[model samples]
Target chain A: MSATQTNDAPPEPGSHRRGLLWDGMLPEALGLCLVAIIFGGLAAGYLVTDYSWKQQSAAAHKAETEAVAQAMATALGCVADADGRSRAGEAPDVAAGPRTGRPSEQVELLMRELGRLPGLRSMHWTREGEAPAEPYREGEAPAEPYWEGEAPAEPRRDCSMVVTVAVRTLGGEPAGELRVERSASADAGYRSLLLWNWGTPTGITLLVFVALYRRLKRHLRPMVAIERNLHSCAQGLEQELQTLTLSDSLGRAAQGWNHLIEQLTQLHQRLQEAQGAEQADVMARFEGAVFRRVVDRLPIGVICVTNSHTISYANASAAALLQRGPDELVGRAVDKAIENPAVMQAVVAAQARSGAGLSVDHTSRDGDQETTLRFRILPVSAQSPSGDALITVEDISQLREGERARDNFLYHVTHELRTPLTNISAYVETLTQPGFDDEQTRKECYNVIVSETKRLSSLIENILTVSQLEVGTARLDVGEVDLTRLVRQMVQDNLAAADEKRIDLTLSLPPKVPKMRGDKQRLCILLNNLIGNAVKYTPAGGQVQVNLEVAENRLVLAVSDTGIGIAAEDQAQVFDKFYRATADAVQAVPGTGLGLALAREVARLHGGEIHLESELGQGSTFTIELPWPTSDQKVTR
Target chain B: MSRILVAEDDPHILRLISMWLKRQGHDVLEARHGLAARDLLQAEPVDVLISDINMPGLDGLELIEAVVPAGLVRRGVVVLTNRWDHGEIRTRLAAWGVHVLPKPFSPSRLSELIESLTSSDVTEPQA
Candidate 1:
């Protein structure tokens, strides 16, 4: 069967054939047809045999009647003549006399003489008109052969024969018919032979039909078992096709189909395994790539360690910060990295506080350079049954520096403001006293108070601005501005302060100073602060010069002054908040130390840097570098 | 007259405490930082010592530690700070019989603490 037809029924074990004999309509129809054919053949044979026997019996009976009728006619003629001779006074033939011989004997004698025989059991023979010798005396006629009237009548017997003729003695005239009687033993013998022959064959045919039915059933037993097995397979039961072993082609076909099914199932299983393996490979690659990139790109130092305290992984930042290579760090115990007892105590404490996961701040010293590190230990579990852990190390050295700087700034600013506040409060209190009510003294005190208020406001504003810039919250209103013009303007604005201190302020600009993209207000503020710092720090007779030069793709500005120079030790910390030079502190300069720090922050916001070059007693030079943008390269801020 | 050294950064607080002590007929010495207090203690023997904890360079805790060995502050040491979480201060000062008075202390409270320390039995080393 084709797949399309098999779709109508449930699928077979291996092929589209119906599993059971009765499962398909066609097989059932064929079985019914076969039964009908056998029964119809048997019925046809029975009808034919019955019809032939009836026809043969009828024909035989007609031929026997004809023969018997001819013999009876001869016998009756002989008897009638003998009786006529005796009645005509002539002596009757004694050998064939009717009165002395039985009718069967007389008929036989007559037939032998006449060459025709009569039926068997014919005892008495009488003429058609002859009466019994003992005639009926009113009601006493013989019961065996009685005559109702004196007339020529037909003879009656158990078996009888009759004869008729239309003739006169010498001329053609109607005469009485002569009849004879005989038994039918010959017909009975013939019927018995026909019955025996017909009955024997019928019995044999019935027996043969029964044997053939049993044989056919036995031969189809395997087919029935095959059907039952196929039904079980179709119903999702486990069918053992191996059990259907036969030395026939159908058994081989079944085995081949079963083999094909097993192969298909195996192929499906292998395909699933291949797909699963491919998916696992892709996931592993993806995870490895992601982990590698993240570890490499992290800015902070990181180190991972196993639960047994062996270092497993270290990033470049961690290696560099620790003053070692990544390979040297791997497989090393975490405690050996930094040998500070305090740091060790902190790590142990954090580990004790948070099992397997810890965050700690500790001070570490690498040779002469001391750094503060923040360590975070996170426990990671292994993918499989073998458990492991990953510990992460982060170096927060810069963060610690920034925090220290901020704390120092707060402490110094508070201290600086407190001095002025105390001075102002004291003066005001003194002025409020009854003895100090002079207008000149009062005006002087008011002036002092205003100046100090301005100083306090500027200090607060600078601190706030620097903090904003550090946190990346400060917005720059960037635009195209000429670097030389801005620097010259800053110098001009600070001319009075320089003149008061007797310092000569000069500006030098290249003829064609390039324009740069920057925040105009922020740049102006930065230049003013630098120039003002020069004027404030320089003593009398000091010279200050502002110069602008156009470098490649950038505009560089330099401000140099011959004033109180910063010491080498304080140069690095000059941009730090509230940091004053040791010399300047001795001189007691009247300026907040926040100017340089604020200037550095402004420069950083413009993606520029300020480089300071100075020596003791030889004024410092501050240089600012900014990127120059072409007309098309400028972006709106 | 007992010469008492008061090492306090705030001048207002110094003046108020000094005025109150002078009114009570005691000689009062004022210093703004730990260095000044050290200088003053070296010059004169103070009968009592009063100091603030948070100061530049050397704080009150270091001053207390320095004064005991120097034998300059002969009576009792009074430590003052604005910080309430002074468990470390208290613990470190316990051996020296140093009294930790939390800041925002009134002038009367200072006088009372000093009187209590001076008037008590000297053998107990009042803190």
Candidate 2:
């Protein structure tokens, strides 16, 4: 019927306060019963009091009337005794007169006094068989209906009481009858019942009920406050109960709520205080989740091994570096993860050493493929009895190759200087020997000595040139040189050498080749190298041709010779300093290996590149392409 | 007379070596470069080898690898080089039956080294 009734089933089996009986109607029934009890009590009590008042008043009226009548008889006897003890019927009748003649008057006076009783209507006397002794007194009887010829059967039947008695002489003889009458209704008793029992007690009970209900409502205020606070808490918003300053049972209930909230607040604080420790645990969980992914992305290969060299973990980097899957590297022996003896031994040695950090350079073989690596090992969780060691590998193959190239370059520089000097000394010493030479041999020895000196100087010069090119210190002497004239001059100088070898060295010029704008001496060196290599590498009866053409806004100088062409394998390295072809013609030819390297450097200095095309046992064509200069050129005499 | 092999990249040095060795009463073979020297060693069993370290193709180490591995050149090897960093290689070469002759060595010095290397009493037969 109400919202409260929705959950007002009998409390759960173990709950406090069972549901109210008759759907919580017992209190209402009790209230109704109380009202009925008060009403019934008042009504019944009013009726009983009214009824008893009537009965008792009537009985009292009858008793008082009888007593008065008896007293009248005794007075009549005394009057008779005084008149010589008159007998019952012999007594002087009060209707006649007493012997003393004052007795009649006295009887009248006594009758009037007896009529003074409350609710008394009349008092009278009569002779035995005669009429009344006197006429009725004024205001005595009003012709009452209750005074019938027969007596009333029940007290409620009449509202009046009448009593009669016979007078007796001193000898105890009956004389005259005496009678008294009074009304039985007591109105004052009815007024007392209404004021005392019915009205007053009902007003007091009503006042008590109102006070009780008001007190109950006051008690409920604290309960409402507590419920409001508890509802907030149930909604996940915490609020402490306000302390009640009362000293009643409701106050006790408020105190209980305040104590409960205080306890809850303390508990919440204890939970909040544990947050920092919980944060560390949460962070550790996060790291555990992402650790593998982060490590897999690292550039260097990383492997983790236990103290016993058991491979515990490997990231993707380690897996790829070792040519295996990340999962495949796990749970194997650390030595098996890397089979290179040097690297394996280095890891073992690093682990065997005590400190946390260790590093070693190792060369590992992937089958026939050798790779240089740098290994760095770190021991994690070192405080634990059996800690894991982290091994990282960085490939240093490029760095090692660079160092090897540097060492080879130094060796070449030294050898180029030393070879000619060795020959010079040997030739000079040979020429000085006593009788050691025929004139012809003597002349050849002197010639060898002079040429060795020139070779030594030229070797020094080439070294200086190579060094200058490497360090970017070579400066160009800018000038203009006619390509037609320069080519003819270079060709003429090489013609003698070509004739000695019987090579048909020829020069071709397009009608309009662009005049070159660059350092004259460097250009001469570049041209001399190109033409000289052609002449030197060509066998007897082979042809060497040089051509200069302008094409696509650039000058292309091409030298083609029927020389021993470069092998496919050696073509890439042919331009390196001190490189010489292994072909028979190139080996037999007497020229420093620096020629092609120097020529390319000179071409590069002029903002061009040299392109070579050749097949083994065929001929090579060297083409130099330079962008044409747009500005005016200077001509030197 | 023991046969000696001389391999050098420079023609003048090669000639100078050949002439001096001829004066020392030893038959000498001349090679212009490492490839030529490797061919000469392949053709005959020379007693001693005088080789240069720096050559155009198939340099001194390559020649040594060819000859020494086959137990050719029985009278031991003489490595001639102008390289200053050849000490480590020279030590390895000497260990493997080769001797070092730095470049600029005089003909007189060359004769002395040849005398000592060819003299059987003072040398171990290169194994």
Best by TM-score: 2
Residues A1-637, candidate 2: write the lDDT tens digits.
Answer: 1111111122234332332222366458759967986797688667766666666666766777677668767776656455443434455544433454355555555555554565556555555566564444355642211111223333332467667777776668665666666665436665675457576666766777778778865765556555444444566763332222222345667666667766865786788779868988999999987987788888888888877878888887788877787589899887787775565565566567646666777776779777877777764554656666788978888889889877777766666666666767777788888656789878888887786787677677777888888787887777777867887899998999899889998888887766768777778888988998888777789999999888877788899999888889988988888787766457656555787898888877777789999887788999998767623332121
Candidate 1, CAPRI quality class derived from DockQ = incorrect
Stretches of candidate 2 off by over 4 Å are A1-294, A340-349, A356-374, A379-386, A424-481, A485-504, A510-514, A576-579, A588-594, A601-609, A630-637, B1-9, B18-100, B116-127
Q: Write out the backbone clash pairs for model 1.
A: A103-A123, A128-A152, A159-A182, A160-A182, A167-A173, A168-A173, A305-A391
DockQ scores for all predicted structures: 0.06, 0.36
Candidate 2: the clashing residue pairs are: A88-A173, A88-A174
In candidate 1, stretches whose alpha carbon ends up further than 4 angstroms from where it belongs are A1-366, A371-403, A412-437, A480-489, A507-517, A547-556, A568-587, A590-594, A604-611, A625-637, B1-127
> In model 1 chain A, which range of ten residues has the least summed lDDT?
A1-10
Q: What's the TM-score of every candidate structure? A: 0.46, 0.52
Q: What is the lDDT of residue A142 in candidate 1?
A: 37
Q: Per-residue lDDT of A537-603 in model 1, one digit per residue for the tens?
A: 7888899999888877767889999988888998999887677765522234545577888888877
